[model samples]
Target: MIRLGGGPLERIVAVGAHCDDLAIGAGGTLLTACRARPGLRVDALVLSGGGGEREQEERAALAAFCPDAELRLTVLKLPDGRVPAYWEEAKTAVEELRGRTEPDLVLAPRTEDAHQDHRCLARLMPSAFRDHLLLGYEIVKWDGDLGRPTAYQPLSPGIAEEKVRLLQEHYPSQRHRPWYDREAFLGLARIRGIECHARYAEAFHVTKLTLNLGD
Candidate 1:
């Protein structure tokens, strides 16, 4: 595999339509990056589940996922599964985030996600974050909406296991769901790892990226 390097990885922005979306989609990548660069700045925005149990779980989960990093999170009170109805609020929130930081990378849901909430947020990202590197992360569900990813973040055996452990430990509210098991999480990671020739990995869809190929 040909490895490519980018500019300094000091800051990143992670946006999700729901409370647990970021953790489920890009937890391992967050873990790997934060560990390597202590005090990395991570700004996270979750569109729904604020001031409730889900928000509580998300705060704790992200704190654990992003160890030793400067993490700032905002959880809105938008109704779940109704993001499109509150389109203006979502767009304003994303624009506000854009005004706050110039992130080296942005992790968000895939534009083609089966879930309406995810798709709505994905579509709004580009409007605010023009000229930024936007990576669309995936979440596996019964809808079977997984698609080919253009980028991969390889995780070590320990980091991969740690990601699972953190998810299981912090998000007890999600445990009742049928798909929230160790095997399911690890199974997806394992498959993505195979694609990138790693023991474990998290995949991402890139709609646009500007390569710095030695000018």
Candidate 2:
């Protein structure tokens, strides 16, 4: 298990292929991190969805979720479902972000995810943030491809509800999806919570982890 002492986190970067992916995957963890550090700066870097009305929706959604955070939200112009084709460009973008901010932690999508874009991003994350602590979050889709997750970040029931509420409120385009509902949110949380022995929690898969067992 990775344990952190009582000091605050100065910077955090959340990377995702789409606008709502970060929120859906790691929204609770983000909320918990922000609450732990009042002045913490959290950046949401979306590889796409920066054009047209999607940009506006993402901006509003981030503002609501991270009111106090110094937001550095960017939606790359790269085409959706084609991130793997632009592998070099995506690496450059992530490297540029790494150059700008040396975050204490980096949150990214898990490598085992069924989505091609998510898996691509997960594959690229280690190259960009080699020295930083990486947390890989999950998103439930129709494929039912959720795998064994080793990390758990517990969330309050209220925060869990707020996550779903915010996702629904921010992305009007996603409301039509049949899987996007309260049960999906709570059911996933409930399952993860059971793993962590908490009321609610989010699970993550870490490809590599170092334990400082010394006291």
Candidate 3:
């Protein structure tokens, strides 16, 4: 198990390929962090949907979720479902974001995710935030790509239910999808919770981590 140094984490960056990925994946962890450390600065970056109603919805949702933290939401203009084609551009965007904000913690998608966009973004995250703590989040899809996760953050049942409710309320566009129901959210969290011996939980994969086994 990877251990972290005990200290205050002030700056946090959550990067995702889509709008709701961060909230669905690591929202509880983010909320726990912010609540534990007041005045924490949390920035979210989405590589696409910079314009139109999607951007507006995301902004409102983030504001509601992270009211106490500073939010810097950047939705790039890159076309959706085509991020892999524009690998260089995606990398450049992530690098630029990294240059702007040096966060203490960075949450992103797991490379083993099913979606190509999520996987591509996961591969690009390491290039920018090499020194910070990185948590790779999982997204459930038809591919069933969820693998064995080494790290888990338990979420309260209320928070897990709230996450699904908020996603449904905020992102109306994605509601029509077959997998966008509360059952899917709770099912995934329940499975992860079983892995971690919690009521509800979110799982992640870590590439490199330092352990501090001190008293």
TM-score, every prediction: 0.98, 0.94, 0.93
Candidate that beats the other on TM-score, 1 or 2, i.e. the better one = 1
TM-score for candidate 3, please give it.
Answer: 0.93
Candidate 3: give the clashing pairs.
Answer: none
lDDT for each residue of candidate 2 in 5-79, tens digit (9 for 90 to 100): 423489999899988888888888877777766778877788887786777888888877775778788888778
What is the C-alpha lDDT profile of model 3 across 1-215, one tens digit per residue? 34345356889888889888888888767766766777788878898887888888888877766758887788887888888998999999888889888888889999888798999999999888888889999888789888999889888887788777787888888888999889998999999989888998988898987765664
lDDT values for all models: 0.94, 0.85, 0.84
In model 1, how large is the Cα lDDT of residue 17?
97
In candidate 3, how many Å is residue 80 off? 0.9
lDDT score at residue 199, model 1, on the 0-100 scale: 87
Off by over 4 Å in 2: 1-7
In model 1, where is the ten-residue run with the lowest total lDDT? 1-10
lDDT of 3 at 89: 90
Worst 10 residues of 3 by lDDT: 1-10
